[model samples]
Target chain A: MRDRKESTPSRMAAVWVRCGPAALVLCAALVPLAAPSISSYIFYLMFWITMASAFNIIFGLTGYLPFGYVAFYGVGAYVTAVMWSRLGVPIPLSILSGGVLGVALSLLFAPTLRIRGIYFAIVNFSCAMALRILVANLPEAWTGGSLGISLSAIYNPNASFYTMMALMVLTIWTVGRVSGSRLGIALRCIREDPEAAQVLGVDVVRSRLKAWILAALFPSLAGGVEAWYTAIIDPDSSFNLLITTKTIVYAMFGGLGTVMGPVIGAVSLYALDDLIWGKFPMLNLLILGLLIVLLVLFLPRGIVGTVTRRHASLRAVIR
Target chain B: MRGNSVILEVKDISKHFGGLTAVNRLSFEVQEGTVFGIIGPNGSGKTTSLNCINGLFRPDEGRIFFRGREIQGLPPHQVAKIGIGRTFQVPKIFKRISVMENLLAPVLSSPRTDQELKAKAREHLHSVGMLEMEDRLGEELSGGQQKLLELVRILMFDPQILLLDEPFAGVHPTLKTLFYKKIHELRKQGKTFILVSHDLTSVYALCQQIIVLDQGEKIAQGRPEEIKRNERVIEAYLGR
Candidate 1:
């Protein structure tokens, strides 16, 4: 049966969003065409997109913007690093451990999930800064402090890149499925009005917490994968705010609640990242800042949502 | 589902915001198959008491029982699962979500299976004649349409009891008959209602029983005819 959750989506311009086995095959096929070193960057991009999608799960679905997603990202990286570097744990276990660690840390601040609008955002943002400062202050032995930690095989460019791509695609597929599910509707209700959602029998705090914990999974997973991909780990590199910032920006630029918005946004942003930073280093930040401002004002629906909405009305006329 | 009897009881529920008493020691019972009306001047703790029963606020004193079970401090959703549903004064709808999505939410989130729930939601929407607006967003609907949407969305779960804060405050003047017609139709379906409204005419028409509150106290209680002619209720409404 046609999904009645949303009416038959008007053509939506039929843009491509890669997911599931096809994504894995696509990445696998493209691996040979790109340079050996390009895989590392691909890994980075995949990890980034996945985290952005997860961020969309919470921020896009619930309207609660967490400016401190970086805290979870960094904590996951550190946890993985500790597991692998100090104890010689398997890559799989270490990454999984990172996810668990992320869940743990998420509970520490999951209370913020209850607050709405700017206050919620501020709490998350402050917590992230606090986490960053705490990580920076730690000594080298425990966490490599500012210098970070590195492992040889895990950091191999080709292998790590492939794994990251696999994870990124997995994260997207999972979130997409969830968006189409009933829990997604619950999140949207909480997003619109917590009190109303509560009255409607939506467990507001529980739903919010579930979204928050889910959002943390990808960042932690990405961190574990990143440590292996890059062969080096440090507080600065592992817990970069760029991971959080770019994901939020990407989700916003795509369409906060729509499934395809974040995926498309991440790809376009990476494209922008390459053209601007590669061409001129100093103008990079300026261009990034300007692009964000322009997008918010002119394309609040983000690229995918705007494009899809435009096509919907046009197709309606055509039909 | 609660049996056909006194399905809910509120005992001396009181909430004071610092020094300002919003709701005070109010007691009432809602029959399982009857429409219960709560009417009062503004700030008479009408909404506050409803809020307490629905678990929006923990009253500083008193208790609420649903189906002979305590529910005053239970989570709103838990209360809802126990067959309690509520609609706000201003229709609180997810503006970004489609009309079908708005209905889909309470259904999917509940333990109800998709088919039974979807059919029920569509049926409820059809009852209110809002099935066409199912594809539209909540914000895009007119005030009347929004109220209809809110009512139908609540009906999706087939709640045994309804707490409507105000189902017809800002509706178009012409739509009054239509609104009351649907309320009566739902009542025939055997759902109990705890309706809060200042529209005494509608209350008198719909309610078999009435409770009047003024300045956070239960000033009068009886059948609509008795309440209408009661000395204190007349004084509260006319201030004479």
Candidate 2:
């Protein structure tokens, strides 16, 4: 029998193996911020990466593809706006409150966990749409109704960009920690077979809830930052379904379950979107649709997933 | 069998799916440290009864008691935490993860440190002669290997009662003998087992007490020898 104790050096080595690439990527992202000409685009890349990584926590790890993930983002943005405008809370604190609100709103939909597969996705999408309409029709006094909130007083693109960059790093770190933890293993087991995981002593509901809450927090924080960056938000913009779709596409395009997959997917695809969106506005959608189709058909596992499958040694380092 | 004390008791449990009665008014007692065999023809509810005992399915009627505490209707994870470990009929191993990961999952839920859990996982995998394939993905394993991995994976929890559903199905003869030996060794260590299998020879050899079911009803219950001669069991196996 092998020894039951893992030596200290081996544990340290495992940590280094996981965190090294993440640190390098964080440094590379930071270096690009120095170039002001494309700082806005950098912010966009960071925002997408953070959002896609967050989406992956639930969809990739636990196999719960939440179609209404943007609901949390919209809720976070509105919560931050309300806190800042009505209660006169500071920008940073309001953003933090937005994350908390994201978690709270996710709890409201926690019962949907009982529903599985494509049904859950449909129900979640409906809930997001319902929430959007409810916000739009609410009395103007509290929510500003369809008019939305304008925080031009606190609008600072540079500050918001830096804040988003920090959040992107945090999101990557969170994914790394989760992927290496026991909770990650339980999540994967639940993804594979919930009944089997339960019989093996994994609390399926609780593990999934944890992943959901974590996933909610990231997009919520990102939304709060984006709201401040834009200085104006309406119900249509706040609860945009396109954000949810784009996040899912980016995560899938990069790979699911690995730390670098969402990052790679978001960076490559967001850049392509930026390049083509202005010149060929109508063709952008068609091109994205074609790319996603091709990806699904030829590279179903995404870039990192395909690479890892082909090379065994790279799996430990990349993940 | 070392103890006469009953470790698990099922009392008049019934489970139904729409018009189909999968398990009907079945009751059984499993003594501690004994191999209790459950044998029935296809669709006879052997798997259903096991599912009920392990909390995979809630009984429509009656109750299940594990170590004198009612366990029926509890979630599967709660049942596992209460010391009931089970394997599925088709060997539901986590296909995307490594064999080492498969073994570590149950122990991770326990209050064990990472080092100790890894060590325990390695030890279990070695014991099952799968140490060499520890890093391979679960799906990469052959059918017999997957079954062995599933068994060893559950054993990591140190479960008091094991509900093994057709552990011998599709397994190699050598692995089958190894499984039987392992079950006997575990029994010797005071672990209780409710084995559901279609392999009659091993079932007859291993179980001191056996039950026969037909059409979701228990038709006979006795020692293997008596069960062999029972007319209803003969009719159930060979058809009327």
Candidate 3:
């Protein structure tokens, strides 16, 4: 298992860069004629995948636990909603502002970024809860508060899914490049030993802060897309711990540090969600919690780790 | 000071851990091309001095100059960008990362130069005689192998002066001699080194000059032969 390197397939890695948007556009083009149920599920998975990938950047590779990821998600949703519904901003403009909000929140979280291991994890969770409560207490007239805001619906599922799919591909491609770059090496170093990385010329705190900001970008943008898709949102739904938990679990399932891990994890779990979730909706969460527990227990390295281990054992037996 | 060209200088560096001083106003100069050994008893601040120089620790007082530039208060990565390389006391080899990959890691400016980094990495691995194991994971390597790996990794930076903490620690006898031989070759080629070691014999053999730190202060600084005859060093190691 030691020598079993995951040679990241250039073809698979380039798929998003080359043809993801085209594929999404093709699928979105067909969505108008397709079944509503299938289209809704497709949009849900497509949007959430990007959010999961962003979470993977911080939580996976850097191994800094974040509980506040959904705070960014909620911010994106509400920003998009307030802009589109009240300000009459274009869909594109509102979502772009959503990305900006993500960057802002990531910056705000910089002070807390210095905390490592479990302490940092708790701070993140606390921030998410605090944001949720703050939104709940805000004047209903502004946030629509408990009632949330109902925006003009985009009837074209094609547009929503295509945009979402494009965003997802953009996220995957950007993260791949970022992780492959010097910044990624710095992050991995910080994850292993902040002190050692520092001595070796890695600015541990700065790198983590940069990662913190980038991580917030996608989840928040996904939140924007989600608000548009559902046509309305509430603080409870927008800032749900479920969003945070699901993204983290997905990344872990696929292979946290590896670039494609989130995508793989998202597809598999969402498939399971689609198959059996209707019969027992709570199963969606129960399965995630259970899978995370089992994966942590038996396969600390996750999917890629396990696959590599198997390959090594096979080689050992042959040798 | 005017007689020699100083590549790296620790200017009155001191580190306080609450009330206790770990490195106490210690200062030293590393010439552009010489092996400087720091020999002291356990808890004598050799590691702390290196950390301060590399920007891991911001000293309570003093400045560090690298290539005639102030680098004391700067963070570690910036220090790296300005070109100082280091290896840990216990090989901080990224265990999951491959041997060759470890060498390629410090090229933070460029992720892939393809042929140049690979050729250099391969050459380094070959020099350490670990080229055959270039693809092996760091954790799989033996103690001697890890030290060799770190030596090669540091070379990736092509640092003007290298800070190595206990390069000979825990290595096999034969490999220890081989490691010293490699260092001699680098010295002959005009590379500088700041080596911290408890191995006085190793220090005596390799260092042109020796700095003996005692209780966070520089107790003696001179040739290894003079340091060996110094009463304070004898008293520091074995009470007067």
In the range A250-302, model 3's lDDT, one tens digit per residue, is 77777777666777778888787678677778676677678779978986766
RMSD of every candidate to native, in Å, equals: 3.2, 3.2, 4.3
Candidate 1 per-residue lDDT over residues B29-137, each given as its tens digit:
8888788999999989999988898888999999888888988788888888888889889999888777877887766655667777667767878877777666566
TM-score pick, better of 2 and 3: 2
Stretches > 4 Å off in candidate 1? A1-28, A152-154, A308-319, B1-4, B109-112
Clashes of 1: 5
Compared with the true structure, the alpha-carbon lDDT of candidate 1 equals 0.79
Predicted candidate 2 versus true structure: per-residue lDDT over B117-199, tens digit per residue: 88788888888888888767788899999999999889999999999999999888999999988998899889998989999
lDDT of 3 at B38: 95
Q: Could you tell me every candidate's TM-score relative to the true structure?
A: 0.92, 0.94, 0.89
Question: Can you give the lDDT of residue A318 in candidate 3?
Answer: 17
- Candidate 3: stretches off by over 4 Å: A1-32, A203-206, A282-287, A309-319, B1-4, B110-112
Candidate 1's docking class is medium
**Residue range A23-141, candidate 1, lDDT tens digits:** 55586648746886566456656776887888898888878888888877788778877888888998778888988988888889887776778998898889888888888888778
Error of 1 at A231 (Å): 1.7
List pairs with backbone clashes in candidate 1: A148-A233, A148-A234, A149-A233, A154-A228, A155-A228
